[model samples]
Target: MLITLIILVLAAIFFMNGKIRSDLVALCALILLLVFQILTPEEALSGFSNPIVIMMIGLFVVGGAIFQTGLAKMISNKMLKLAGKSELRLFILLMAVTSAIGAFVSNTGTVALLLPIAVSLAASFHMNPSRLLMPIAFASSMGGMMTLIGTPPNLVIQNTLTEAGFQPLEFFSFLPVGLICVGVGTLVLIPLSKYFLSKTGTKEKQRGYKNKSLNDLAAEYQLGDHLFRMHVAPHSPLIGKTAAEADIRNRYDLNILEIRRITVPQSRFFKTISQRTAPNTVLLPDDLLYVMGDFDKVQHFAETYRLELLDTHMPEERSAINRNSLDFYDIGIAEIVLMPTSGLINRTIGESGFRDKYHVNILGIRRKREYILNNLKGEKMHSGDVLLVQGSWNAIGHLSQENSDWVVLGQPLNEAAKVTLDYKAPLAGVIMLLMIMAMVFDFIPIAPVTAIMIAAVLMVLTGCFRNVEAAYKTINWESIVLIAAMLPMSMALEKTGVSEYISNSLVSGLGVYGPIVLLAGIYFTTSLLTMFISNTATAVLLAPIALQSAIQIGTSPYPFLFAVTVGASMCFASPFSTPPNALVMPAGQYTFMDYIKVGLPLQILIGIVMILTLPLLFPF
Candidate 1:
């Protein structure tokens, strides 16, 4: 008992600090339990083999295939470019994208991929990143409510109950409530985000590229916007001419982003001047060409002219300073991460003495709460400040050193990246829907996990995913680790009878009101804690306790379990509680109090909904 208490306390503290990695913490706890003979090795590692674990892996592969396909980018280019039209439109479209994807892929997966695009699009529109970012984060949560595989919280609850004894929920069992939540949530966000978010919401357009609207890309892109491989054949008519002389651009409307002399193992560089080159360069046979044009046009040019266009890899600077150092100041501007923990996490451009520190000038600063003058150097760092710094490459690298916590964003160079899907290349929406239908109807006679796995397998075999490795790369591992790590704590709550202890204490006082009141008590307790810790972590901790209490009181556990699940996920009151909160925190320039101001009311509203809805929907 004492040992379990020690583990519980330690787990609580570790989860609270969130400094150490959650998975590592979970691994340690699992080992400790096994060593103390509190659980058998099978029980300790059971989370790894849990059905949810297996299902998540397969689902990630499916999600990866979607990512590699660049479906979202194509979608974003169409929807996001017009974001300046209305805040409500942007909110609806962005959340709709996230939720739709969330229904198919995992919520965390949706956020990891969408968040950066959201940041960039928000920047493109000169809107506050906070306004859109937080909505996407919230959408991830709300959307996950729509589908079982949409988030780990739903799966965790389903799996835990199944592992304990009750039949696990079917993939679509939560659909009714999930859809309602998603619909209501999206509607609420549209009107709310403009007022609650959008600091310095400005309207801007691309400075130089008078490119056509994004609709063109949606209608045209096949694999990548600016990524393709081409080969220059020996007998090709333009073989010995200079690359610029090859008329690559004039002939195909293809922007040759990068070029390499080698045919195989093609590579990329930023689409900028490669200075210090030989005066009279000439194209050669077997040379690799990296170009960007209409996807089909590029492919057609590659095949028609025997030219190899390597995928245009836009090398974004990981550190704004490093990028700025590389003469990126020539064109690609640096956006300062206002907070020290931001990509510019620590050491202001000024205190690192950016000017004397590196001949760089601070262009602008986006404070978490309000727009501040760029000159606030002596200010102690806050969380979401975008400091637009101007510098040379050397100075930028100096800023992006090991001791600091800043990050840079630009062209995502993910070796971990799978080949994106070809827009205009055809994913066949009907086919995708059919796959989901197969799962919902049990025509495949397997779990939803297997259904998704089979879809990925078919996609690869049909060449939709391109290759096996590409499909595997799309899975989000952090979410899986979070689930595995939190599983043990949930188990320990039951194993130590700590759950029964807490339930007895609560029921003894509320017993006179029956299980309904006890359920409300459980709901409030978890909801309060969720305001501080992560929603997923909160859910994991309370699930076992809810279960034990329901059994002890001789009533169905659904009402109590439902309360804990919904409450744990209700993280509206504080930025620390959810990623959506943090994502928007920087843009809104809000203080901790802001979340409480708006969120407290919403939290109350949610509590009322859960109290009324759970019993009516599921029955006590």
Candidate 2:
């Protein structure tokens, strides 16, 4: 009893403050549970090896590969164009597409793919992106509940059912209820989405943030006053001044990166010097000087030295401008921005083989403020690091073909790579065949994990992920660690008889209401908890309770199991409910109230559906 209270309190506190990393919090709790003898060490570590856990992790990598290729972007774009006239039609179209994709692929991946597209579509209609983004996210969640592989909850419940001597469910088993949820959910979306939040920005910024957090990675590069980039242009009085007079280094908190004379060619590639160039060197038109230091201090020095009088300019690294190593029959060069949720994050360049396999070459990589060489320095990469890759002409052939894990920062390059532009369509078709064959007539059981892994490599072999190592350089380690550590906590819940106790207590107290109501209560409790804690942890902690409660009430466990699943996945109440929420928080400039206004009603709608509709479909 005491242990339960302590664990619950610890979880509540952790969820309330988003300061610590989820994985770290999970690890701490796991250790605490073990120390208190609440769970064995083996139980704590068991989640790492769970088939479901392994499948999810492996699938994440595959999803990353597809996203990196830019295949999903094209598809979403087409949907936006096709939804021409009506706002309702557009909302339905986006939601339907996301739901369809989520049913077959990863839910989070589906959201990541559609977020920007939804935002773009909303902007086209002159609507606030926040309105549409929440729907896309909600729709993705609803869509995921339709298939066996649609969501982790479905998979968890299915596995639990099988363990209890029930036959395993088919892939589309949840489709029946799934369709109903979509139908009802989509209807609610028209009103909740349109009227709920501020309507000025697009969903792209609402669901995902445009600005990257510098604090997470700036510390890694040691961003002191050395080797900085200060924007200056042509015709400045300081253009011909000596370094000593510019006072940029000694007086200003900085060091000079390089001095360019006429063209900006080699200037983009920084060159640091201890000694200043001779005054007689005569600074030419548009000479860019790179200096590092505090932005404020740099500004002060520029103001005092009148550096702006020379011409300060911003540096642009467009994807189309990035060069490639060799010719891809239909490829082009591009610099792709990696989103934090992308699967390609936290991977190694050598392992991804984007170069050797896909015929693409990485020119440079950037994360927050840390910029590494396109090829070598970024060989060890992390999430949010922009990778400059040269793609073949078929880069824009199809959403799936150009599917990738990175964000397209600008338009695709026209002359970046050898123009196989016409041939690009065929490559896309080939990729489609490969992906479909892998997912459907699986003579080799090509699940999402296998299908995507094979496709990612084939992309390289076929020159899609031109730089094989790029794939390896793109995974998010923090998420992986979190998933790995939480599994054991889930296992311990079942092993320690704690799940039974909690379930029994809750059920006994609610006996007057009966089994289904009791189960619903349990699920709602979990859903509410998830708005604060890690949704994964919520699922892990409550999953056992759901099962045990159903047994205690002598009802079928499937309904109860699914109730918990849906509840755990519905993280619409608070910003902390999901990583996606945080990603878009600043871009929308959303206050906590904004999320509540938008997410609260969606939560209620989903809650009613889960409680009333889910049971009829899954059966107890």
Best by TM-score: 2
lDDT of each structure? 0.57, 0.57
Clash count, predicted structure 1? 43
Tens digit of per-residue lDDT, candidate 2, span 488-522:
65445555565546656765677468876786687
Task: Give the per-residue lDDT digits (tens) of candidate 1, residues 397-452.
Answer: 45545335444432212221322434312452333455566654534576665665
lDDT of 1: 0.57
Off by over 4 Å in 1: 81-84, 96-435, 455-476, 513-516, 525-605, 612-620
Q: What is the TM-score of each candidate against the true structure?
A: 0.50, 0.52
